[model samples]
Target: MIPTNIVVHQHSKVLELSYDGGAIYKLPFELLRVLSPSAEVQGHGPGQETLQTGKRDVVISSLEPVGHYALKPTFSDGHDSGLYSWDFLYFVCENQEQLWKEHLDKLALAGLDRDAPMTTKGHSCGSH
Candidate 1:
């Protein structure tokens, strides 16, 4: 049987979820984003995942529950894709530590930092 409780430790970056099957899981924020199902990050086809960088300090501003088994997460960066399903949330929470480490490794190999400065384009950025 799965448990039925969902809790988040924002400061520690931990997301605790309980399933109705007597199972509980705790996941990290970074891991969740890295494994987001959004097209911009996951791509439109196989072997086409776009790495998300400069999100180290990103936090979950809001977690709006969508229906009874999904979530609409609003991040501090204003990116709100990647609807998290029940199974997906369970997966992440179950394997948080390892997944987080892997993300760190990937960032290191790519030589990118979540806090790195990125030049914004468009008229809003002022002058070309």
Candidate 2:
């Protein structure tokens, strides 16, 4: 179900997705960036996923709709490719805690932290 309202709370760095059923999800910008569905984040195939780091302070510069399916959020750090589909976004809202934990685990395994400077070199959206 597509959200009835999408509010980007820049001060708090959260994206609020409100549904018709009154479900509201406050997703952090960092979480969104890390979980972006683009190939840049998910890669072209299994086991090729790139670990995103140092995005704790990332903010949404803008949110652009894509046709009738997803949103393209331009991040302050210059990332503007991941297409957050309705299905994916709903999944994110439903499993936010688990997804966040997984992201943290991945970061830890890579010896990285969200607060660190983004230095891990890897593709991150439509080509640079």
* Top-TM-score candidate index: 2
User: lDDT of all the models against the reference?
Assistant: 0.71, 0.89
Tell me the TM-score of each prediction against the true structure: 0.73, 0.90
lDDT of 1 by residue, 1-128 (tens): 22388777889886777776677677666667667877757777786667677666667888888777688787777778888887777667777777777877877887877556533422221232
- What would the per-residue lDDT of candidate 2 be over residues 1-128, giving only the tens digit for each residue? 89999999999999999999788999999999999987877888899888888888899999999999999999998988799999999999999999999999988888887787766664554555
Q: Whole-model lDDT for model 1 versus the true structure?
A: 0.71
lDDT of 1 at 19: 78
lDDT, residue 59, model 2: 98
